[model samples]
Target: MDERTRADVERAEAALVEHYPRLVRLTYLVLPPSTGRHRRVLTAHGLVQRALPRARLRRPDGGLPAQRGPAAEPGYDVVRLRALRLALAYEGRPLWGPAALPQVWGLRLFPRVGGAEELALDQALSAVPAPVRAALGLWHLEGLDEDAARSVLARAGVEEPDAAQRAAAQLDRETETGAAALLNSAEFDPCTVQTRPTDLLRRRQRVRAALALVAVLAVGGAAAGLLSGDGDRTGRPPTTAEQALDPGRLLRTPNEAWTDTSRVDFTAWPVRGRQAGDRELLGRALRVWAAPPADARIMTSAGTSTRPPDHPPQLLYAGQIDAVTVVVFYDGERLVRYAEPEGATPTLHFARVDDADLTSGAALVIGRGNGWMRYLLAPWVSDVGVRDLLAPAGPVHGLHVTPDAVTDRIPVPPEGGTGCGHWPAAQFRPSTRIAGTGVNPPFLLTDLNDLVPVHLTSVPPGGAPAARAGEATGTPALQGWARTACSLGTLRGAGVRSVDNWAFAGQRLPEDSGSATWVCSRADTWRGPGSVTLHFLPPTTRPAEPGRIAGRARDTAACSSFGAPVVGNVHWRAQSGKWYLLAAGSHGVGGIDATGGVRVSGHTNTLAAPAGRNAPDEVVGRLRSGGTVRALRP
Candidate 1:
């Protein structure tokens, strides 16, 4: 290790030793078991041991540079929280469940304490919900003020403080004396020092055993690629259009629509006071794909005029050259183009898009927004190669592009599904035409199959089966078709949990799924019924060595963002049935608060830092070399 890092580790270790006693006391209080006090204490010790190596020590001012090793272990509270989560997970309870049940000894369980006192205490404490119990523990046991208690509760997923206050009052009335007695009990002393060398050695061995368990369970390999900070490109970025420059507006639509008409209704509008440079950039991005005829007039962007008054006016230009349609979008530095043939896919001779292709498009132009645009092109874009499009847009970031992005064809979806809204007519074909892109997107995917399928096992509240499925209720008609097409067996295999209608609608779909694209769009009742297009989705792409990093990383000061040092937790499960905690800390390096954790695996003794920021591979490397992984179980 370098002198600086070694020094930081030494300092942190010294702090760990100094704060070890207090850390144990806090863990015992937070996770007082109904029995087995000594065992629980040992577990808490191991958790702290494991957490320290991975923790980012906060300075007195709360800024992070764990190497500083402040006199006070700002990470003490973080250790307790991590311990609480570990205890809960070990016991198979919700990590955020109510504050621990009173840690009564043998006599209490066998009824040494007065029946009245025990009953009152049990009633009061158990009655307190998770947040309230946590609050009470912090206030009465830990002596934290209302604000501090509230902050802890909030981190534990409790938003409001009123409930905690109310529970505290209840505890005061019911078992104030009993609580005092429990605190003063001989079995629960927080200040007791463990001086026995043999006992300490034995405990250390147990901690090692726990670490072994984790290492055995952890998947071993290189880490997954770095995830993107920008969310999966499901929606367009906010436009920064200037409202003051109102030369001419484009075709404003209330909602987005996709139609077969190559040429949207286009009427030439004067550029009024628009900048020549802005116009030039727009032309270049479009010319790279397919240039419109010189006579083709530019139409105002659809839906800019009525954009919310607070939102930036959007600049969009649409034009047609015979069978080809070109639409350009500009939001300051960001520029996008939607180029496609009038009714058929275009044959592009260019192998890839580059900086020279689109002058200002360098690195700034994100390609995931061009979802399914690849299908419209011949000699489809390669998963790894499509990144070339962003060369002109600047540093090209990687994203998990769907097969439809490269080719329009997919395996024939099961019977009963149909295309809805502006979706093209369904064309049943083989899946080979659209092979899966075998990499996870840095951001999450919001594909059609990701939707939760509602099964009408029982009629829903406020409506019948057909009535319950409406436009406002998220493509119920398509959902119904999905329900019919997939039997209970299929749905179960597909991970669609069937619930009563109302409850189902309120639930969220899982982050990942293996089903194909199930398109549903709103239909105009007056014009005709909506459509539901179905395409066989590719197999689910599983991370090679799947793992998660539950922590924060440094976001970019600008583009080319990397996951800098962060304080968080890492967990991994491999195909070999290994599941283990890679690291735990209050301060984590490299921010990665995404859905699936970044993939990472390696020897517990050695660590690797990622080569680039925001790259999945970078995250894996950070976790590997970021800090020492303690064998102690979380």
Candidate 2:
């Protein structure tokens, strides 16, 4: 194994070759047209990347943490936007926050946003289908290649790969026409893109950026353990900005993201769990939804807010990160969800508290079909695997209705399906890294939110404290509770692991895939998200074999001015904020994960940014065995 160089390209290529399959997948959201064979393939490519979550790139001295922007220090806003895009792309659907797609796409559609409970959509061209929104986002905002764009579409649907290829061509032609309108629209300009009023993306980015970071920081101890635990200060700020955008925030009371009292029929829904109302949850869900999913402190005060009775009320429930049971009862003590948050126990307080009246676990929720249905969104009432990504809905784990309605756990069908149609790419896994390694076709995966499946089962039921229950010897031993699904055993300890591999596993410190030792302990939900701190030992072995090609290069559409020098074989995600230019075969730096997902070598990059103010846009320089990296422009 050897090292990788650290520098960006003189310019990036816009062609399919230039864009990494993962990046193409993200951009395909903006791809003008996604019916081509190219789009289909790109969709497939993206799906793979999402599942794999790794993007191979050259490292100069060592690897740099992935950034949001293309400069030594990227604009905070930019990184926030990119992260949101990634989250939304989890299920191949464009999960919108506060920000709108680039002005051009918005221009194509008319505005459908209204006051309170108002959603931001385009009426310009009927409502842009979820697919079109994703395409437009990738193409217009992310700027992916033609053929690459098609790859992403393939994941969504496009049984015929050949047709997907043709659609990419048509999409490009449509893009050119929209480009002119975009430049004239408010979005093309930086000022408007950043500061303009009336625009949602820019505004949402402000709030969403901050909130996103907060949520990430708020969740359970494992979340806290892995995220902002050690004072391993890179001197970098905790977050560039708050995730100011929360599309649901614009709703009347900020809790409008949920339907007041709608019947979410799970008789046929997958991974059953009733939604916790906005008000009933008190403000807990709002805060949690805005913040990260784990490492949250269940504070009585946090869920104690009140609301009017007739006013739209929100509901909430208590459960594990994997599954949260929804119970809407109105007893004397459980007036506001907050008061009863501590219903049976203390840790199990109001998942959300509000100023409303509530009662027993058995409550009535009126609806059209069932007229009156008992709403108990319990977690994993029936244990269903949540990994199937491409399905419209996964299997219904538990279908326990009263004997009269539907009861008993749905038997785990022996033949892998529930008579539900096959999901286009249920098993597709996309790499988290966007620009690195050879360009694979795009593919869609499950929604990031979907990853938060309502898993049920008695893993220390009653949300009991793990330490006291003695249920801490399993794969994920926790003092109180362990982060769901993710156990060091599965990816690190002898269970199909990798070393220094961010390509598949998450971007943890050191990122060692095999024999990767990380500390997972319960942390305080209130003070710090948790006490779990995952530490990857500096690799003693190199990650990749010598001469193993990595990194990326593309035309200008993805990077700079139109027709800029074709930046080829450049590095991928060297730095977060800055983009720089470097020549290939400079010198290998940092580390790489050896094949078979086991072994690691090299170190993180330590090169200086080439571009003066915002250099290092592209890190992961393509260096040789023993070469030194030099500035291309300088």
Candidate 3:
């Protein structure tokens, strides 16, 4: 969580200047040479011209650190590095995978600049593709592991590039004797440079002086410590000895044993589900609850370590399920935490951790019924560690858990069939204890039975208007035609097909029974295992007519489906409810495809941003403020 100051960079520069010749030689190996004939863009003349000298450095101290190295050099051009990575990637060269690149480089030269060279290399990585270079540098240079690197590579989309024949040819030419010629060899150490005789002699003099001075200081410091009878703390301060430095240790670690998971596969992750019954909702919406595949891996993140890509992991995590969102959690590239809502109040999560679980960092707090489901998104992913990925606009989380953070498992008071084997909600004891500070966490109760169960009396076939469940009033019915065009991005959600517009209907009188209607599609709906639907309706409800939007805003479905026989129906029924006609307009069933066609999308992760489930093409309201209109069929 600590930030390196500009002064730290200056110190690195001085080190570079003091060791320019070797550094240049190292850089030269990476570079194709400055020969005029160089067309591979080893000629970084233009890019280096703009970038290098412009490079600036700062030290840990607020004041300036001595500068003479690349940090201080006017031009800290890294076009060569960028060019190198691009060439390797574009040409599909058999260089190290992105995650292990830096560490692999370290194998060639053990770094000893006391973090200076390493820091510079880390910075240089940004000049290239962030994911690839960072992953590679972390694996090759720093001491990350295979599990850590796998996470980085997945984020970078970099994999084992060369095949067997290519790899064999490359190995023959690179195996010790014929190594340096490979484009990605350690010969490219930017720090290694050609040196002049005079410069070499001066370098030797400086090195000798620096080493001699260090010896004198060490001996003097030892004598002083011995004479004073001072205690030694090894690398740590005495006051902090026995102090736990592993940030991960303090976290409420995942009961890895409790979670059932598997390796990540392109297709086998999503479980089979139903195409009939209440399976229909919206034109297309991602099945909210997904049972990860038994074969999916845990998405091993070795922080760019030695783990090879082909080696499958033991669990498929939320990130692997949804790549982009997961990267937001695994990458440590951000610093702040936010608690934006699916439909909750906004706040911030503030915490700075050097090494810790994502939950250990500041977590944006949120609340829903039953104290269940607190979704958080952290910013600055994967810089310090995988925990840095999720940064969103949420509340500022202090050091302790909030009331909303503690959720109780809802008890199964018998509306049920085949309950879970473990802690069944029916056995859970109710506690008068309030949630949060000093109180035991809330317990699950047959809480729903107390609230009026919404009733669904069919309206038969009628020409009426549609509104939020339990709040329909007189309005123009859906007219001629209303069709939203689906593009390649339309079905991009995880197994999402179309939007579902299902809710309870309110009659003119309060005493009348509430009815339900459904608007959905069956584009990508599948029938499989452990499928669940979560209604993440954050109460964005403004004052409706006289009071509040009284409809229950809770996700209410989680069961096995056997509806594939009715896939043609496109409409699914609800358990706590069923469908009837308010005023059916031009609502129909359809799906979008790739190339802006229909039914051409390959999978869900590739679905484009915001697939229009919550989007509204038009509005209908009373003749005045126009502020009270409800969003109709998504």
Candidate 4:
């Protein structure tokens, strides 16, 4: 009505008309996808058209502050604020009402179909809450920084705008082309859309079906009420135990069956626990496995399924260890372990060992507490010993076991430390039948945060045959492992099935320095590609120190049974106080070359050249076939 107010209204109207398409696109991106595409297009346009008056009449005390930077124009900022607020308010509410404006009839309008990337972006946006989508659109499509987006979100009535901004940034990082490119694609453009006719025949058929189903349900409800007796009528689903089979029906193997069976896997293990026959405790374990309680702690290895077994599972053990009740079950595909303390909630763990062999299925950690772990050995394990991997010549100590085949608590090995103190590993010798030979050698196994322990073995330095489980006990193999054992800490919680250390290359230093050995340690995991690490062991003078890491890679086939060549380089300081560049490769490599800071080449699998400290260089290995392979970096 007043002159000043009239001029402000005109300016706001002009801004709305000039930026109509951009505002509609922003609202369309921020609007929840649950509003079917046809309705969304019309709603976005209607909201922007109505934003001009709301901006002009906004209350001074509650209105949004003017936007900063390029969007700081008096009219554009107010109009954008009003439009964004209106779009956000549409979430979780009906898209259209009887008196709602801009309604379309007998037609469906939706954006054009896009490529796979656009479809993936659309689905990702739909998975998040509406406020997060708003932040993404403002920060990406509108080109606003994170701080500016947060301010806009706060003024538009989001309770936790900072959290939304963080979520948007994470989502952007996950996408291949970023959210900005996908939001700008034609797949989300409302102005460029395809049209289709409404399906009247399907609508009529759905109405009739709904009416008939309602009438049938009404009649069925009356008949059920007449047959029901008076009792607690609260309608709640059955509990987890009530839905599963009774504990009495669980499958159990005979105590002596393992002796005669040819299979050496978990199926041969007999029930050997003090509480093996407790039906009440078994029932509680079954319920927790079926549907864990809210307070229950759960852990699973990579690619393991959490679904409960469909049939009755076989019980392997149910016992008390360290004042805690532990239960073990095998469902043919998974090995499930459940532990419950006296006054604390239970913990459920699942691991996938469908392809486990005799060496891998020999032991499982049954209990762990106070920096110690107890293992349940196979029924055929006749002897158990603990060995310190860091001390090759240290005597092996005998480990005591109970009649149930569970060993006494053994100190857990140190994950990593400033010094190579000690690393404990379990050694097991099987019975004559399981060993299949007159002479039985002990197998070495170590826990790596999984249900089944990983087997540790080694290949001798001079290309001796690949060592079996027991062959790693030789003097040469043990000495090599003493220097390589500390590096195994990196494989913790990696789902590794086994690790083999190969003393592949040994090279004499260039300037009268002592010989150094190159050990390629490859960890084979249960899922995905295995990890490979090249370790550089200095001369014998530094026996107290662990091998220095030279190079590493993930998902590489080098140094495995397939015989792929691997190359690595390191900067070494000799006893003469001079630095040199040292490089080595596996057997198949015909030549090794180094470029950049130092230039050197060798026809054999090893090469060394004088260089400066921290000198940058690239190393490559050439095969007999003339193909080049890059070295794995540290």
- Among these predictions, the greatest TM-score belongs to 4
Which stretches in model 3 have alpha-carbon errors above 4 Å?
Answer: 1-93, 97-242, 245-427, 432-514, 517-617, 620-634
**lDDT string, candidate 2, 62-82, tens digits:** 766434345442232232233
For each of the candidates, the C-alpha root-mean-square deviation to the true structure, in angstroms, is 29.2, 28.6, 24.3, 12.8
- Between 3 and 4, whose TM-score is larger? 4
Q: List lDDT for all candidates, in order.
A: 0.31, 0.26, 0.23, 0.76
Indicate the residue-level lDDT of 300 in model 2.
24
Candidate 1 accuracy as lDDT: 0.31
Q: Any runs in candidate 4 off by more than 4 Å, and if so which?
A: 1-244, 435-438, 462-470, 542-544
User: Candidates 3 and 4: which is better by lDDT?
Assistant: 4
lDDT of residue 573 for candidate 1: 37
User: Candidate 1: lDDT of 407?
Assistant: 31
lDDT of 1 by residue, 258-306 (tens): 1222212211111111232344433333333222222222211111111
Q: lDDT, candidate 1, residue 577?
A: 44
1 or 2, which is superior by lDDT?
Answer: 1
Off by over 4 Å in 2: 1-283, 290-407, 411-634
- Predicted candidate 3: what Cα RMSD to the true structure? 24.3
RMSD of 2: 28.6
